[model samples]
Target: MLGIKEIEAIIPHRHPFLLIDCVEELEPGVRAVGYKCVTFHEDFFRGHFPQEPVMPGVLIIEALAQVGAVSILSVEENKGKVAYFGGINSAKFRRKVVPGDRLRLECEIIKQKGPVGIGRATATVDGKVAVTAELTFMIG
Candidate 1:
C-alpha cells in the first residue's frame, strides 16, 4: 500500500494539477489502485461549464494515466525512467463526475516490452464506473 507522500516520490504532480490523491495498492508490473478527489474549485471547471460544471473526460483519463505512471515508476527496475502518454485507445466517458466526487482509479498492466507498455484503466465514482480506457505509455 502507498499513501500520498509515498506516491509523490514517484510522480511530480502537485496541487490542483495533481489528480492522484492516494495509491491504495501497487503490484509492481501487475496492477495499481489510485484515488482522486474532484472539487468545484478546479480551474478547468470554470471553462468546461460555468452553470452545470462537469468534470472533463480528458482529465479523467489523465488521472488514470497518472496512476499508471505511478505503478510503473514505483517498480525498482523502472527507477529514473519517465512514463509518457504514448496513445489512448477505446477511451469512453460513461457518467458525469462533479465536485465532491471521489474517483477511484485502477490500472492493470496488460503487456510490456522494452520501453513500451500497455494497460487498461478505469475511474469509478460511488461504485459506478465513470470512465474507462486502454492506455499506452513509453516508460524508459
Candidate 2:
C-alpha cells in the first residue's frame, strides 16, 4: 500500500487536484488498484451541486487515470516521468458518486508501444461500477 506521500513521489499531482488518496495494490507497469475517500469538503462539491453534492464524473475518470499513472510510472525506466492523456474511449457512467463514498479505482495496462499505452480503467463505489473507460496515455 502507498500513502499520499508515496503516491506524490510517483505522480506530480497535489492536493485539490490529486484525486487518489492511496494505492492499495501495484504491479509496476502491469496494473494498480487505488482508492479515493470522497467527502463533503471536496472543493468540487461546493459548486458541483451544493444541494446534492454528487462527485463529478470527469474527476472520477481523472482519479482512475491517476491510478493508471501510478502503475506505469512506477517502473524503473519510467520513474520521474509523467503520463499525459492521449485519449479516452468507451467511457460509461453507471452510478452517481457522492460524499461518503469510497471509490475504488482499478487500471490494467492492456496495450503498450514504447512510451505510449492503453489502460482499461474502472471506478466503483461499494462494489458497484460508477465509471469505466479505455485510457490512452503517453509517457514523457
Best by lDDT: 2
RMSD of each: 1.2, 0.5
lDDT of 1 by residue, 22-124 (tens): 8988887778998988888889999889999998999999999989998888789887677899999999899999999999999998999888999999999
Q: Which sections of candidate 1 miss by over 4 Å?
A: none
| lDDT of each candidate versus the true structure | 0.89, 0.97
Q: For model 1, which pairs clash?
A: none
Error in Å for residue 106 of model 1: 0.3
Q: Residue 68 in model 1: shift from native, Å?
A: 0.7
Model 1 clashing-pair count: 0
TM-score of every prediction relative to native: 0.94, 0.99
